[model samples]
Every structure is written in structure tokens, then in C-alpha cells.
Target: MTSSAPAPVAWAILGFCAVALVLRLLWLSGQVRSSERLVTYGLLLGTASGLLRERAVQDGLADLGMLSVGLTRQLSTVVMVLTFAPLCLLAISWSERWPARQAGISGLVWASAYASGIAMLVVGTHARSLELYIDRAEGWQTPVYFAFFSGWCGATGVLMTYTSIKELRAGDLRPIHRLTYLTILVVGAWALEEALSIFVSSVCAATGTGGGFVEFRFRANENNYIYLLAGGAMVAASGVVSELARRLRIDPASRAVRQLTPMWEDLIAACPEIPRPANPDIRMSSRRRVHRMTVEIRDALLVLGRYAEPVPDDMGGHGGEAVQIVRALRRKQSGAMPGQYLRLQASAPGRDVLDEARALSKITKHWNDARKCPEAIPSLDGDRAG
Candidate 1:
């Protein structure tokens, strides 16, 4: 007698593929950065593999339309292997910061599993004569096909599990940890399902005659679809929760906005010459005496005589204090002595002089350097002479 397993299995796989597609699309919609394109690639690979596997099993052939079904089975196996390799690398990379070595190890693990699976598929296809021997209960050789496929999935599942737990323990918050955990659980479930699938298929392959316990007609595809739907929902839900957590930690302000707001007010107070954007100065006064005094003080530094002690007074009062502190620091001395920089009680006026003093001190350093190293100074006369 025949069985009804194959039809429902086919439909279930198709339905799971549709839902996986939806979840992936939703994920891609939220991410816009070019650096995040890996996520898109992974989602595409996984979805394509599942769809291809479903097509191969249900259609009983591949798109290439080879008369032999063995080639299609091998192709499906390859797709499954290729789909998870990048994901495993991503998981390892995410776990450790800037971990090229860890990612390489993850790749190696994936490669080993992929190789083993392909090798078994080759062996099973070529040695079709084993089916009869296996039916006669020919020991461990009977279960070699099942064992190979199960081992391949189990290895990946273990790596994903380790990575998830490692990251979670290391305080990776919100979306990253949650995403990893969901991936781990999905991989574990897939591994289990693969084992079950192999067991059932192996039984069918081994027992050439019908009526052995585990029949090929036993359908698990519907149940597998339900599992995938649940897994995908969990993963997407975790991502949403992570996004919320990120928002809580860091607000929505752009980096420039965050940097400028605190410092702008202070700068405006320190440098009154910096005209307010709203009010360009409309009036000009015959205050040449005031401007003349300002220019004289600025030019005074340019003419400080040689072989004189770099006068501390020329460096503004705060400048003098900064020089003293630097000397003390250089000597490895630590104790508060004279004037120290402090943000003070009065916001508008108390620290205004200090800002001015600091500016003059900086200019004073330029003059001091020139006095000590005249050769370092560029001369207009020298360029003309050249």
C-alpha cells in the first residue's frame, strides 16, 4: 500500500519558504548601510537553499532536468552547505571583536562539514548496491549515510551554540546577543531535524522490501514548517527588542548636533569679536586709540629682544600659571601651588579672563619658539634672495 506523506510534505515546505522570505524582507528593510549587506546575502542564500530543496524533493527533479534524481539531491546538499557557511563566519566574527582568526576557524569547520556531506552523497550514489546489504542488517555500514549527514549538521549547531552563549555572557546587549541566541536555537533544531530525516530515509534505503518500521512515506515537512515559522518569529522579535534597547542607550541626535551644543555657548562668550549670526555690527567708531592699543600689544611679542628671559608677564596671567604647571609636571612634582584653572561661580565673567589669558599664552609659545630657533622661521627676504 502507498502513503499520503509526500503531498503534504511538499506543500509544507513551500509555505515555510514563503514565510522565511517575508521575515528576510522585513529584516532588510530596516538596514540601509552598505556594511550591513552581508545580512542580505545570508538571508538570500538561506531562502534560496530551502526553496531549491523543496523544489527538488517535490518536483522529483531539478531545474536542469537531468533524467537522474541523484544529481538533484547532490545539488540540494550543496546549496544547504553553502547557505550556512557565511552565517557561521558572521556568528564567529560577531562574538569576538576584530577576530579574523576566529572567523577563519568558523569557515574551516563549515568546510569540513560540507566536504563530509558531499563525500557521503558521492559514496551513496555510486554504491547503490549497499541498499540490499543494509536491508540484511549489515552492521554500521548500513547507517553510514545517515551518520554522515547528521554529523555535518551537528558540528555547525555546536559552533553556533558556543558563539551565542559566549557573546551573551560577555555582556553583548539587546539585538546582537538576542540575534545570536535565536540563530543558535534554530541551528540546533535544524540539526535535530536532519538527524530525524536521515534516520527515516536510511530505514527506507536499507530495507529494500516494503513494510519496515520507518517508511519513506512518513511526512514531517508540515511539522518542520511550523518549527521554521516559530524560529523566524523568535529571531525577528529579538531584533525588534534589540533595536529598542539601542534607542534607550543612545538618543537619536546626529554626532555633529551632540558635539556642538555644549561648546557653542562657551566659545561665544570667550570671543566677543566673533559676531553673532543675527547681528552684524552696523556702527563704526573713530576708536583708533583703542584699536591702536590692541595692535601694539599684539606686535609687542614680535619685538621681544633677544637674550632676555622669556617674560612671564607677556604670557597672560593664566598663561604664566599654565607654564608653571607644565614645568612642575615635567619635573614629576605634584601639588597645587598658585593659580589653577577652574570653571567658576559666575558663568559670564568669572572665567572670561582665563580664556583670554590662555589664548595669549598660546601665542607667547609661538614667539618663544621663534626666538630659540630663528632658523625654523620662514623669511620673506630669503625667498626673494633665492
Candidate 2:
């Protein structure tokens, strides 16, 4: 008697499904309003369907238990059909350009395929199960059952893949475009598995025996399990990529374009003669770097302003004292500027960075000079003017 291969892969698949569930729960509990949350739900539902189907099918096979193979098959078929609804909803909700007309058409197609497939599977399986289980034991061959599963998965796969690719190409969620591409690729793998299963079952029936076709049967099953594992992990991974991109604040497209698009329009309205250049390449990275440097310098000045007393001049040279102050402040400032500016730059840092550093240094000098001259200390209004 030939037996099925070891189930180590199935167990591993279950482990990932469990991890995915835990991650979803953690994300939902967090305070951030994240689109990742929606993707997480779709992923959990997809993987849970696989897990339960496998468990139900295995239990039926092992013990001829309360759940028959026919019922398990029907349950799995229904679950696979329902899986697309959440995924479709996720794609539609996240999409900025999924227009009402496009969405309505897509919805009708998905609903029809799913409804017809489930309906046929239910009716056919019930007919075969009247006297006995409608699975292999009943010698029942309902092409409609397989056709429904095939059609539902095929339609969903095409719709989601097209929608995801279009959304990315249209530059929605530009920073997370790679994740979107990965999602479609992963879903394509699932479509391939479903197609393979349908093909294998049909070939087995035509051949009138499982001989010479057992390998395809095994491959088809393995692909299903692999598809679930890879697809679930990819969805969760895409969610993580999106969150990480947001945290890093990296815009994949032209950040300057995104920023100055509205600002420039307003500027043109205010000043008509301001000629807009044709193909201007405004690199925002330098501007961002300078803005960050300014923040660091301000923070350093605040730290240095807290010092009660200065080190004695004899203890170190004037330059050494300056370096000490810069060092003491660097910890708070997170090394925004050079500890020894003369060493770091042949000329000086960039104009913006140097200017901010100089401004901070001047403020510190004024505060120290004022502390030394108590007579010069002014009232609140004078202080405010200063």
C-alpha cells in the first residue's frame, strides 16, 4: 500500500499560519491607523481556511469521523471561494483609483464566480452523499465541483493581480510599490496551484487509475500547501515593508515634486513672473539633510545652555574647550555636527549646516557672556527684544 509523503511541510505551514495570526492580533491592538491591518485580516482568513480544511480532511481520512471526506471537501471549497471576498475588499479599499464603475463590474464577476461555484459544489456533493460519502469512496465524479473551484480561484486571481498591478503602476503608495508587486506575484503562485489541482484530478479520471499520475497528485497537493505558506508570508511581509517605509519616511517617487506641486501652484498665483522650469529636478535629500541638521544643532544648543559653569582656561586650550562643549552637547544632539568642525571639513560643512551651527554657537556665546555680566542683565521686555 502506497502512503502519502511526510507532513513536515504541512506542520511548518501551520506554524507560519500561527505566527501570522499572532502578528495580526498585535497589529490590531496597536494605536496606529494602518492599512496593514486590513491586509492582515485578509491574510489570516486565507491561511485559516487552509489550516481548517487540512485538519478536517485529515480527521475524516483517519477515523471516518463525524466529518466525512465529502463534507470536508465542500467545506474547503466554500472557504476557498470566500477567501477572495476579503482580499478583494482589501484591494478595493486601499485603492485610490478603483472607481465605482470598475469596482461594480469586478464585484459582479467575483460574486458570480464564487456563488455559482459554491452552489454547484453544495448541490453535487449533497446528491452523492445521500447514501455514502461523495469523495473517492463513492466513485462520484462531479466535474461541476472541480469546475466551480477552478473558476472561482481563476477569476479571483486575475482580478486581484490586475488590480494590484494597476494600483502600483498608477503610483499609489509609491514607497510600497515593491510590496504590491510581491503580493500579486504571490497570488499568481496560488492561481497556478489551483490550476494544477484541477488538471491533475481531470487527468486521473481520464486515465482510470492513479498510477503514473500519483506524482502529479502529490505535486498538486504540495503546491497548494506551498502556495498558502508563501502567499500568507508575502502578505504579512508586504505589510511590514509598508510600515518600515512609513517609519523611515522614504518617498520612492519624486519627493520634491510631491512637496512643491501644490506650493509651486500657489507661488505662480502669487507671482506670475516666476518662470516654472521645464523638467526641474529638485533633489529634496539635501534640503531634508539640512533640516535635520538644524534640528540637531538646536537640540545641542539647549544642552550647552544648561551648563552652570565653564571649564577653567588653564585646564585646556580655547579650541580644546570648544571641542569639550561640542562633545558634551553631541550626546543630546545625536552627532548632528562634527565634534571638531575644522578637522571634519577642509572648507566648512554645507552652507546651511555651517550657518545653523554658527547661529547655535553665537547663541551659546551670548548666554555665557550675559551670565558673566550681571549688571547687563535686563528686564523681561528687554530680554524679549534681545
Candidate 3:
């Protein structure tokens, strides 16, 4: 069946899929061998192939003689089978801590199933409108064709749902990963529902009890495709947004690391016993590096506190603490006697480790000036003596 104008929902779904496909493509460009890439590949294949099943797209292709309606329907099923390959691989790679050999064996089994399903679908089903075939086609072949397709979908859905649930239960997932798995869970549930519906409809047709249910099932299946495609696209778009958020966080931490490096070096030099990992892991993320540096700086400050004099009432805040820290470093370096040990506090209290890094970054700026003229600040002991 063809319509001169497609439904408004169809256009909306198509537009959403197009935008999502573009974002996934952009994300894929930067990824290398990650789960995100596998998910993106699945979305790309599913979305692109799903367009073929749209009535408007099929009508257009038929008009141009590029593909008949029957051919488009068959091609959509084939592409769907192909789309699951990447998704299954993702599930296998994530859910199993298995060695490469075992993972490969599992992959091979899934590959064979997919290949067999597609072969059965193409060879058993005739080149006729799928809607009509499902509604009116009478034969053992018709039910068998639908059984294989629905069974494949059911298996895929079960696997995806199981993997998603397993991952979610592991806890401590990043926000992006949590969102991705939740999306998978939703899609898997929908797939299971769609598979069961298709299987029941096929059985009804084979048993001559279809009645008006066939038409409802056909329309329901079409709606299911729309939901599936739209859901996939939205998840891909969310991935892009998540990537941007991650960059925003890392970029500032990276800048803070650079800003605090000099102060960190000075503190480390004064407190040699402050445990610095001789060989820091180069692969640590910027946020982790910032936390590590903040902790080490705090440790060094505690040790240097032994040489620190009390801060004067006038020299209070972070600027004052920065000035006192410079003097403490000088006293330690010059072999001065260990005197008062005043606890250092930041001018602005931090809410978290990253905030603490930013607070220290501000202190480091003041420290640069204090180190240049440490003698200008009078010693508390000198004041007491006077």
C-alpha cells in the first residue's frame, strides 16, 4: 500500500533519525574500539535501514524503480538482522570477562544464527507485499518464515535486556553509560513485545483465526518500527551531549593541573618525604590527576606546617595563607627552627575535589607573588621578641 502523502509522525521520525544519525557519525569519527562505537554502529545501521521500511520511502523507491515494495520490505528485514550483529558483539564484549578465544566462539555462533535467519527469510518468503502475506498467505512456509524472524528478534531482545540489567546492577556506572544501558533496556523490552505480537499474528493466520486482528497486528508492527527507530536516534543524540559534558569537565581540570604544577613542585621539594609516586600512570584522566595533585599538595602543606608562624590578623584569607606558605618553604629551606604550626585553610571552601583544585589554583597565583618577596612579611617570632 502506498500513500500520496506520508503520515506526519513518519516525517517526524525520519527527521529525528536523520539528526541522530549525523550526531552518531560525528561521535564515531573520534571513537576507537569502544562500546560507544559499537552502539553507534548499531544505531547507524538500524536507522539507515529502517528508513527503507517507511511507506513514503518505499513508495519513492518504487516510483524510481530502484526497489519494489516487496524488495524494500525484504531489505529492511535483512538490514535489521545485520544491525543486531554489532549489538550482540557489544553485549558479549561487556557481559563476559571471557578470553578472546571464547568470545570469538560466541560471536561465531551468533553470526551463524543471523546468517541462517536471513537465508531462511529470503528463500522461504515470496517476493510479495509482506503485509498481505502475513494477512492472507496460506501455507506452512508463511508461518515458518515468521517464526524464524520472530525467534531471532526474541533472542536478541532477551540478550540485550539481560546484559543491560547485569551492567546496571554492577553499580557505579558513569552517567552516560547508565543512560545508554537504560535506553538499551527500553529497546529490548519493546523488541520482546514486538516479537511476541508477530509470532501470535503468524500463528493466528496459519490457524485461520486471524479475523480482524491481522490488520491491527500489521499496523502495530509499523508503529513498533517507528518507536524503535526514534528511540535509537534519541539515544545517539544523548551520547553526543554526554561527550560534550565530559569534555567540559576534563578541559577545566586539565587547565587547573597546568596552573597548579609550579606550586606542586615547590611543595614537593620542601617535603621530600611526602610520598610522590615515582612513576605516575600516564593514562590517568585529567580529573583524577587534579585530585591526586590536590591530595599531595595538602599532604606537603601538613608537613610544612611545622615551620609556619601564625598568620597575622591583617593577612588572613588565601592570599595571606599563600604568603605564609612561601615563608614556611623559605624557613624549611634555610634550616630555621620548627616553630608554630598553623593549620592552612583556603579563602573559599570547596564543595568537592575539583572545586578544591580550583581553590588551590587561585592560591598558586598569589603564591607566585609571595615567593618573590617573602622577607617583606615579618616573622611572628620577631614580633614576639620586639
How well does each candidate superpose onto the true structure, as a TM-score? 0.44, 0.48, 0.66
Q: After superposition, how far is residue 246 of candidate 1 from its true place, in Å?
A: 14
Leading candidate by lDDT: 3
Highest-TM-score candidate: 3
Global CA lDDT of candidate 1, please? Answer: 0.43
Please provide, for model 1 over 5-98, each residue's C-alpha lDDT reduced to its tens digit, 9 standing for 90 to 100. Answer: 3556645654655555465466545675322344445555545545544444535543446423444434444455555565555555554453
Candidate 2, residues 8-123, lDDT tens digits: the string is 76656667766766755764436344345555655665665566456534475648666655465455556666665655555555465655555475567557756775686665
Evaluation by lDDT, superior candidate among 2 and 3: 3
Please provide, for model 3 over 37-58, each residue's C-alpha lDDT reduced to its tens digit, 9 standing for 90 to 100: 7677778777766777778788
Alpha-carbon runs more than 4 Å astray in model 2: 1-5, 29-38, 53-57, 60-65, 97-121, 124-141, 164-176, 182-186, 189-193, 196-219, 237-386
TM-score for candidate 1:
0.44
RMSD of model 2, in Å? 14.2
How far is 76's C-alpha from truth in model 3 (Å)?
A: 1.2
Report the Cα lDDT for candidate 2. 0.49
Q: How far in Å is the alpha carbon of 339 misplaced in model 1?
A: 12
Query: Candidate 1, which segments miss by more than 4 Å at Cα?
Result: 1-41, 55-64, 102-114, 126-142, 169-218, 221-386
CA lDDT of each candidate? 0.43, 0.49, 0.71
Of 1 and 2, which scores higher on lDDT? 2
